[model samples]
Target: MLHGAGGSGEQVLPYFTALGDRLSMAVVAPTAQQPVQTTSNLDLAGIFGSRFRMPRWDLAGRDFPLAALRWALTELGADPNRCVLAGVSMGGLATWNLSMRFWHSFAAAVPLNGALSIWESFGTDARTRALLPNTLPLPLFVVHGGKDERISPEFDRESVRTLRDLGHQEVEYVEVPEGAHGLDTLGLAEGSPLFRQLERRLCRASRTDQSASISHRANEDTHGRAHWVGLDGITPQRTAEVHARWTAADRVDIEASGARRVALYLRGDRLSPGDMVTVTVNGVVSPVRFTPDLATVHHTFQNTVDPGLVAEQVIRLDVPQPPGDEPAEPTNRTRGRDAETI
Candidate 1:
């Protein structure tokens, strides 16, 4: 859970605590670290309706919120795989942005009366537009008040429309006619429609496997990896994408763009030691033998802080770029540069 602008974690934590008690779950609400800063655009005053600096989520940064979540999970000994993210107003916008960047971090998301600028933020750029669909696999329940004064309901509606246009089918959008800025009045109630939906969905929720077939996109290294696939040596300010899937128990197919290297994190459950794993990247085939490392499993757990994401084996492949592209050598790791399989 996250708090809106000018709000503290204590404000939302109590509500989440009661809701968590009812649902037999643990809850944590993290406060935004920075206040809304001044922008050079003069229209910002009229658009945001702010005369002075006020608290707001840092939509551009991913570190603070993610670190808060890790801290909460560690302190409470909570199951990171079973987490759900929920927020109201400014926090709701953060919910949408974070969910899009890190879909694997939560099972579902609830954004109530979000102050969103979805099309303006992500749709204007061709690179961001292409990257949006890859991060929307998880379910979302979006709510907005029809009579909101501070932020218009059109924002939420347009966001939902854009999401649907991007091929997201697991979204539910609700508009409360009598509600105002504080839609949480109806949304947070124990037996409300929104609450009931959350109960039903969370009761049976299960996260997608990290080793499962994946299609992911990223612009920077801060939030690059998705599922079991990772990208490195990507061109700055350009979107890098990777699509990978298991064709057979020991065969994998991959496609990459705007990246100099792609990595596949394989686990023992998916493939055995000494098995000849066939990999195909951008129409290039390489047959490499699998080798499980116990240290990799431990390091993966340490780095990700999620047991479900631990991998016993890892394979890296260098991507072939067109002429005039100056992609650097990866600082991480990889193997199987030659010997075509087909």
Candidate 2:
């Protein structure tokens, strides 16, 4: 849990108190550094408005609270895999930024009344546009005020749209009717929607493995897929000719444990007749054939490994490659892109 600008970790104590013993997990709330100096020319009410912006916690590559949080997690013996990143306002922006850069580190994220990108307050450029899609597939539960004048609701809406367009399946957004920038009016008690969502996510984390997967549409169309975890050796380049679809040669790496089988689901329309995909698990490879008549192809590999041993599995397609073009490396943009309204 993180705090918004002009706020500190202390402000969130009430939320913890509200949760009581329902939340047994350790909480870490790091304060944002550097006081925001006020200017006399600015209207105090206007400054309090949602439109008024402050320098982000990590602006210009300074990561005060994030670094503090990471250290605190270690000291507290917290499970990184079960951790949740959440915040409001400027802290909401920090949540989005940190989650993107460390997508594999957390089970879920909740950003309230936060802009999808810093470009809402800061300006934009071509470089920033490339970074927009980096926040893909991580489960996000976004809450915003429909009547929020501080940071328009459109930013949150656009984020959901862009994520869905990029094939992310688990993004959820909720709007509080006539709600303002703060969630004070919305009860944060047990059985409330917000508490329920957090409970469900934490429960899922405790029961699931760390296995991660990426879709080709995320890579080719939206440029949203990041590098795979537990990857070994060399990474493949995306051939130029296969830019729009998943070819037989596209590959994804997954680090698995306590696994009995691996499943690969492919969109049939993307494959040409007689196209084949290869699934490699711990140095063993199996080839799968695809036909035009099929709408989806499900390939399963039978292999069992001990849960204690971390294994790296690679899946590559055997498709035609364009001449002279290097395989496309996965794109990773740690920063936010230009803001686009819904």
Q: Give the winner by lDDT.
A: 1
Clashes of 1: 0
Off by over 4 Å in 2: 35-56, 59-62, 121-129, 206-342
Global lDDT of each candidate: 0.69, 0.50
Q: How close is candidate 2 to the true structure, as a TM-score?
A: 0.56
Candidate 2 lDDT, tens digit per residue, 209-235? 433343221112222222322221112
Residue 41 in model 2: lDDT: 12
> What is the C-alpha local distance difference test score of candidate 1?
0.69
Clash list (residue pairs), candidate 2: 50-150, 237-327, 237-328, 238-327, 238-328, 248-317, 248-318, 249-317
